[model samples]
Target chain A: MLHHTLKISLVAAACGLAFATTANAEEVTTERHQAEITTVAEGLNFPWGLAFLPNGDALITEKSGTLRRVGTDGVISTPISGVPEVVYKSQGGLLDVALDPNFAENEYVYLSYSEADPAGGPGNSTAVARGKLVGNNLQEVEVIFRGAPKYESGAHFGSRLVFSPEGYLFVTLGDRYSAMDDAQTLDNHHGKVVRIWPDGSVPEDNPFVGQDDALPEIWSYGHRNVQGAAIHPDTGKLWTVEHGPKGGDEINIPEAGANYGWPVATYGVDYDGSIISDKTHVEGTVQPHYYWVPSIATSNMIFYTGSEFPAWQGDLLVGALKGSQVARLDLEGDRVMHEETLFAEAISGRIRDIEQGPDGAIYVITDDRNGQFIRISNADD
Target chain B: MLHHTLKISLVAAACGLAFATTANAEEVTTERHQAEITTVAEGLNFPWGLAFLPNGDALITEKSGTLRRVGTDGVISTPISGVPEVVYKSQGGLLDVALDPNFAENEYVYLSYSEADPAGGPGNSTAVARGKLVGNNLQEVEVIFRGAPKYESGAHFGSRLVFSPEGYLFVTLGDRYSAMDDAQTLDNHHGKVVRIWPDGSVPEDNPFVGQDDALPEIWSYGHRNVQGAAIHPDTGKLWTVEHGPKGGDEINIPEAGANYGWPVATYGVDYDGSIISDKTHVEGTVQPHYYWVPSIATSNMIFYTGSEFPAWQGDLLVGALKGSQVARLDLEGDRVMHEETLFAEAISGRIRDIEQGPDGAIYVITDDRNGQFIRISNADD
Candidate 1:
């Protein structure tokens, strides 16, 4: 950003101490495990995304558009009704919240958000939707897919969705960051990712389905804002993570028509730290089965196949919002051999969505305006 | 922003508890005020702008571009040397710092940052420089004034410099938030308010000096991101505060070429709450001697005229960052009438610059990486 602020102002003036602790710690032991954390639901607002429900309750959402449900006994519930309007500024709102691998029998639910320019066009993008739920409300909603040429910068709205196991659906999108060169163009869908079919159509084997210059629901393009996504129960693939910019964050695994180079081959640098691409490997793009340099801004991701930390099953976890913690990783098949972090100092705030529940534990939520939810578990059980 | 997040998600779902305490408080009593906050100077990092030195030391800055110097006996000094390079991401770094209404016959100083885009052109604006300090180091430097058509979104930067009374220098900018229609364009300087001269020249009575399509160091036009500016020791006028979106923060006073209607007459709404203008009063623009509806996100302000809080003298204090606290206000001439807040529980963090200290005490800093310079005197001094 200005040559990383003049190299941290001449290395913090030759280290005479410019400080850097940002505390944290409610209980963390990690050698292969320890955790502890708790909260389990306490208010909630900037909560952004979290799913769950086969009756264990959960839902969440909030960046300001509300969706709430909570209750595995921690209480919460209210605000759910129809849910759609969102743009909640800064990082745009009501983002991510899944459910519907036939939620029992199609009780559906989806969500994602940021959408405003419904063609009145002044700026705003990233949409998604779908609904059904019924009881707390949301019966027949349906927006299903948006991300296009909208701008007005309320900062990037990556949106993160994820369905696939063959049910298709994916989503992701984001380079709305003043449209970073339309994240390597493709007839437009800002940073691309697309895929669709939870009723939003598209998906004919996606990846530019019938490209007339592309956009048939592109599958992957230079993505510079994909806030965490997941699948990999054993590699049904589709991984994602995104953010970067002042330290490239990435994760990726997209596939299809792939490009994945953002602001051209970035390994991060540019939130004014400038340098957007000294080439973190270009030429045909696609790298990063893991990245993150000074960024922990990553947001939602899952995969641990739940069962409460059997040394963290197949590991992955994620959710960070500027290093506020969770991370985990440790996979193997697609890389990321070891990473850890989890509740670093016990959820100080901003982890935003982690999920695992069904009783096995883990959950999380935090990006505040009162946000908390949390859970973790197995401090040696 | 989405109808204020659907009326706070239907009133926090009819108040089932979504939480909103945010804490704060090291000791406050307020009737006429009690105050007792100390921390003197703790490590530092995101601590943007402060400036004291008539020998009482102070100086600060550090939005990762360093400049230290802290002692009135609080000891911080270490990274000062010459201070320039900044654009430290997000709110862009090393911003606001002043001194030199002939800083005792030209020791100068002045700062304000975010630059980067010096014609190689890509994006980044907001500049200002000046130097000369000579002790912890600075000697000569220069830069002067930049702010023009840059565009890359690190979020609205609206720096804050102030000096006026006739010595001119003002500064205040910020429509960089995706250039909200270039804050009512006047040939671009993003959201205007210029007036220079401590060597940066252009101040032939400003207000668009010789307007050949405006830009002769402008001096006021629609705003939308001004991070606090001051100058009314007795109506020498100037005021300012800005940053509204999801409840307009404002304060204004500005005048000169006037305008001030932001995204065209706003009381704020668009942080995804949408509705940038139902017109808070259009005709010739200008209206807001005070505003703030759920946005204590203000930052940097001062008018108190110090003496260890005579009943807060001319009272005006301010410094907020998403309401982390210290509002105070009170005034009557420019009409505010009463406000209060201050540490709201005791600085839970994010206050960012608010000075007065030449021994009349008050100081404050916060915006964290670990930041904390604080002082706030008179518990009954």
Candidate 2:
């Protein structure tokens, strides 16, 4: 068990050291802020994910489990048909949507969701299925990955999907609100982030491949519900966002076989305000690079590296659900020089998802009926 | 109640409007399809709110109710010493944080949370307060606003804070759980977004200010738990995000006395998979500009107008908690042109808050003990 305290001063100094770099307090930034808000698409029913097609259009997903073809006119084509029925529920439904890393030729699309199980088992688990674009509907739909130890709750089925440049598929799983301790276990898929091949087979060279002591699909463990994962644009390092119970949401640079210490070290308390764990910090349990205390109820994140906003060509953009806003970070070296809140009063809804489109535009989906397919561009700013 | 099915096709039409303005479609971008992940600060318990000092440092808030001043070195100062104890419970704690528009003139910071009843009343309704920053400790702390008809549940205390450029402070309120019927009532503060003066007084020009039919603090009524609100940088329009049970999370632009359906007109079912109200749309209830069929557990949102990232200069960044990621939105007008997912795999946590820093950077607060204080900058993405 890790010892946890609401220490203010002690952790302050160590936090600066963890990042290995510091911001120059004396330095001045003359750059200005100029964010424009324009409507890229009007009506979208819980557009969950975005994939920028090479043709300059985009493919989007709806939580009710529909694949949409959005063209330059913002005209959404017919539901493009051919999607499996998702057991849509609280925090469950057609979730994150992704495109093949090499979509120019194959037109393959990867979708992540809580698939309906006809197997007379638990209701749903994190599932990743692959298919190619045949006309409008998805063709050759095949299950590529499945989360294990499925259970009854819809509270924590993390079904975000991503792909490595190396072509491995990374999928996230929630602990199904049952096994808080199982997040630290290796045998079950609950509360784990897994990596698999495109064909739903475990990669032989994965972090714990062929290891008796570890789960074969695990790239990382000890996560409650991981929603966001992206490969670093510069270093290609993988990073993830994990949810905490009452607080303790985390952004981690997950290493293979590392224990994240769920039901253990936590800055947050339980839902009923119970003690989060016996301790807050434990040796051998990986510490998060950063954490939120009051809990923003975070959703999606992206690194902006486009020409539309030249000065901001290399920055980070993250969406917050509870706080109902977006945060932009200013980094100098490895240290954050400053941080600010933008649009806290503008887009009033939980920002469900964010993506960078092929045309270099940034796209976001609001998880509301007024589930707007809002777009951001230089012109609007 | 609002029927979303009729709007589903309208949603399709909105997508068409979004496609016409592709912000980055013509640009030859430098960065490929990857995002950068960097942790700017650690040791923040629940860095609920992030704001920049004029000199470019940051002030962070923890859910335990302590405010920490974060330096560029990532070092956190001990608690600022002057915050009032919060009614920290299931969903009640030191909640949203914001800066006074005149922070440069008078280091005033505003906070909103469910405060324990010093007078020995129920601790459910939220309150807003302001204090001056003198060194690390807050001075002149004053209760600027208070909620009415205090209930008992810790849930639905939409306590996020925001300040309009017009000098009015906006406070989001929750239905405090199934107080769905409470949203339609004016005597209670259950489900409504309010506009208030800085001194804890009701604004005279408020939409429902003089009317005996509604609470004086009410800016708009008929809302569920409105967790997100923002002021549009261009139009200065107030946008809001509200959560519906099972599915219908919503975004609304407020009109005086407008009704946003809670128990009615949602795409979502109940937690037990039951119908909320037989209707998905109503004649008088306001409709969401966008919605998620499957809820994303919406939180805060931000619109970017920073020069640091030219590509995303004018975009919206939204955070999803249950969906566990940040979303970037490219806008053409009011519609979403594209929807993209960022940090879907990096942080396995729910996003609680998002902010843009003074140095044209992005700051994010995740809600977990491992909750994170992340900064995004030009070099990182």
Q: Name the best candidate (by lDDT).
A: 1
Fnat, 2 decimals, each candidate: 0.00, 0.00
- The TM-scores of chain A alone, one per candidate, are 0.33, 0.87
Rate residue A85 of model 2 by lDDT: 72
Model 1 chain A: lowest-lDDT 10 consecutive positions:
A1-10
| DockQ of each candidate relative to the true complex | 0.01, 0.01
| lDDT of candidate 2 over A343-377, digit per residue (tens) | 56545678778777766766776777646665666
- Write down the TM-score for model 2: 0.47
Q: What is the TM-score of chain B alone in each candidate?
A: 0.34, 0.88
Model 1 backbone overlap count: 24
Under the 3 Å rule for N, CA and C atoms, how many clashes does model 2 have? 212
Residue B108, model 2, lDDT: 90
The residue ranges of model 2 lying beyond 4 angstroms of the native Cα positions read A1-381, B1-34, B379-381
